[model samples]
Target: MSRLRIHRFAFLGDARPFGDREVIAEPREALEPRVRLGERPTDGLQAERHFAADEIGDGHGQAGIERRRGGRVHGGASISAHARARPGRAQKSAIPDNPRRKRGGIVEVPFRLRFAFAMNLSLYVVTVLIWGTTWIAIKWQLGSVPPPVSIAWRFWLAAAAMFVLLRAMRRPILPPRDAWRFLVAQGFALFCLNFLCFYYSEQVVPSGLVAVVFSTAPLLNSINGRLFMGRPLRQSAIAGALLGLAGIGCLFWQQMAGHVDDRATWIGLAIALAGTMCFSAGNLLSSRMQAMGLHPLATNGWAMLIGATILTAGSIAAGLPLAPDTSPRYLAALVYLAVPGSVIGFTAYLTLVGRIGPERAAYCTVLFPIVALAVSTVFEGYRWSPVAVAGLMLVVAGNLVAFDLTRRFFVRTA
Candidate 1:
């Protein structure tokens, strides 16, 4: 007399595709104590398949008794190994979570973050440090190599590194033919043009200035989402955008001061704006690709290869220099971009875009600058001006408005 409860399983990252699974467990107490804290399995089958005893704290309880007692099966359930292999397969019988009825071995987890703020904070800091310093790294490579050439070489190296890593793990390198064009477009917009604009703009403006300007990416993305996809535009979105824009204006005004006539600075800033536009465009493109069921990591790898080809072609056409002295700083920066910045950052960002959609994820651009500012403070001894402080405050306020963080505050307070 087993009560069948169908369970579905979903994976967090691109390592696995989205698939449903079914598991028969007692309708009542089938999943109680065995579900781990913060473990979000799609269904009971997934829980049984992925969760370990150590991972799930309590013993598996009986059906009707626990169903009537514990209120609901909010957490903990284990899926059988057989259930995971053929996700489409129908369940034969109820999978119990009883400690006394333990059967198979535990699945090994690759990495565990425990959903701690400190863990997230650390990851955020690492991401920003890698990104912020890359600005200076990018600046250093400017005269030594042509912009497009540098980008081509950087991505070639990145592609190579990613290839080796993926291949070592025996991950498939080949993707469908249709995926190539989309990957190339993404790479060009995301890696090539995005970097080119930023680098060239830096030639005209300070890195800090370029960063401050790029912070508007989220606002642009929000607008793009609304116009392109017909997503509902919230008032908070408009307010948030305006607040962020006003903050940028403050920074611009402060920087311009009596030097507003500086043509080069203005030009550079304009280019920076253009680069941000490209970044926003890439976000939209990636969103489309995700919808098509392409994994971000695989797509990014292929796109980098495509971007590398396009950039190299451009470099050849322009007779740009391709070589840079393989100094420690240069190599280090390149590796950082290849791994943490390009690989890790793109993966995180794209996945986030897939989950929350591009608009909300663009918030990372805003926060990333704060990370950059902190790095600037340490490495370059950057100090805030009174006006800069005001601008920072405005930026924070604007971000709150744009993302509707204010709503969260009110909700919590209420």
Candidate 2:
């Protein structure tokens, strides 16, 4: 081996000369010249790798290339002296290391990090299950209560519960003035008009079908974001939108085809479509609010209150009685919708948005339709035809494509 000098800071020994291919593997305490080392030099300290002059280089044996480029090589490896060097108060030295863990040592996976993954997974499950089942709960409220009045009760209870939760968590309940206007828009679109459309639509169609329709919100958001916010539309999003639209068409083929079935089927589809548009609009407003430094939870609480107020006022003006249904099932459904559906589900999903990312958290939209449809078969006595099954497949496939999950999985794994 060609002679080469490897410089290591003060380890457990004096300045040592590295022989050809000699590896001085040991616990090393690196210190600056004439500067005292810290009390815990071992804190996050990594090992230094020495290499023979012939060990690292291109085919032409340009081992000094790194040195010529103001750095040095290590152990015939890609990691260089300049790459892992940490600057201390007095001295900086090159070391072979991993930012996530120490090199050639214990892989320090933190206990909290493992739990963090579990917690996020739990949040995703709860959000999907609760939102999906709430379709049946919405259907339950339809028998006795007027749709507007029922929604008012749900949001009033939900708003109160959400405010209490925010207080317990010590988050500020009132949003900034800038966020209030957007909150109003979000409330109308998300809480009031969105639910009103769905509630009315469900009165005519199966609740599970409404969920399949609502699953198109992501596509709607993509389209509206492009139209209103000037975001570039992706080709995949367009393809997904076309597939989802075709699926909706198939789901209502007989009804829209003007056969002998209920005429309200087509009307229900239109209403659900309008509601999805409102939902997509609300999502954009929420994005704007988030950009203004508002937490979605805070805006959601305020929006629920505003939406409840609007629904109550609208109900009174329309001469609908404000009293809630006295039946046990109705009351139970109301509480479930208020607490778990709106408050808990929203909290979990938004938490996931913050933790995993809005992109991944929104995948919950893809899973909940299956849960809703499954619940529908048992409770609503909804029979799935071959066409309906095909529609469901298309919708799910479109969501997967729209989300670019294939690309994402490959990117992460790669």
Candidate 3:
């Protein structure tokens, strides 16, 4: 006869019995022909014995034993098998059902979060490149047309193209009546007044200099967000803003030192700053519209149309030419400004404002100057000075500090 081997399995939280009996039995009775191990007897002795043995070990011990068995335990005797057999008293899962939970001490990012991050990064790159180049394109539009008229034409073409694209996608072109009020306001601030100021500023200043003044947008966005949206004022952001302002002053000082008593330069700086403020306001409006379930492209589409209409009427009343520029370079610039600069660039930027908060989204303004200055060097003969370089560094440093990138890097490394 085979020797009676008692396998004790302990389950930490389980109170169920295991094997045939609760007490140990002598080998003669345990291995009796009537107490067959392979098959159950009609008196239910084998079932009782199996459960009695299982009750001896903790859940961890049972898990260890099951693993040791290479998950090939026979007779439905494993802890998992027991849980399956008795559904009510089954052990709960060790891994959480929450998608964000860590497994084996490693945290996992969900697919949606990764995809969103990628999209935001791509949008940032695209917005920076387009907006940077748009300053030069705006210069091309200045020779033959009034500033407001040029702006009107640019946005009018942009609005028409947006509508055509929307129609192609079978998306609704008209905003809801309730949204029209906000769309009108967005139009004035973003498409109409902002561009008008910027275009006029470009006439008096180098486009790169205008871009430098406009780089104050992140600071303005933060202040506006705190005042209107009730976002908490961060010390880092405030410090960053001050540093950026100082940098701008340094750059301006360099310019003034070179050309003192230039009224147009001062006026251009003031107008560019005002336009930046308007840009920040538009950011907030776009954010609000996004919160209200209005898509950025749709809002921008309607707003551009309203802005174009108003600008067109204003230009007509002001006796500005309503005729389009026929020059190849001017036309090319207009098309580029309408499509990529206004349509694609605004869509990408406002989408970022919705995805990230407006304050963070405005950092793109900080980056825009670098691209603008590079383009200006090639086209407008922009020369970099030591003071200007220092100012740029300070501005870049401020942004890093404001966004907490510096702290995050240290923390991650530590």
How well does each candidate superpose onto the true structure, as a TM-score? 0.68, 0.65, 0.70
Per-residue lDDT of model 3, residues 1-414, tens digit only: 111122322211122333321221111112233332234456422221222221111010111111112223332234444332222232233222465544443223344334544666687789989987887777677778888888888999999888888888786667778888889999999999898888788778865477567767877887898898765566766677677766665654554465336888888889988899889889988877765556677899999998999999998898888998899999999999999999899988887776556766777877777777777789779888888788788878876676566675667631
What would the per-residue lDDT of candidate 2 be over residues 52-120, giving only the tens digit for each residue?
211110011011111111233443323434343334422233332346854343222334234544666
Give the Å error, residue 225, model 1: 1.8
Compared with the true structure, the alpha-carbon lDDT of candidate 1 equals 0.59
* Cα lDDT listed for each candidate: 0.59, 0.61, 0.65
Q: Show the lowest summed lDDT stretch of 10 residues, model 2.
A: 53-62
lDDT of 1 by residue, 209-323 (tens): 7766887887788788778765556566567666666665565455546545788888888889888988988887777666554656667787888889988888878877667
Q: Candidate 2's error at 358, in angstroms? A: 6.8
RMSD of 2: 15.2
On the 0 to 100 scale, the lDDT of residue 327 in model 3 is 94
Clash number by candidate, in order: 11, 0, 22
- Model 1, position 93: C-alpha lDDT score: 30
Residue 72's lDDT within candidate 2 is 34
For candidate 2, the lDDT comes to 0.61
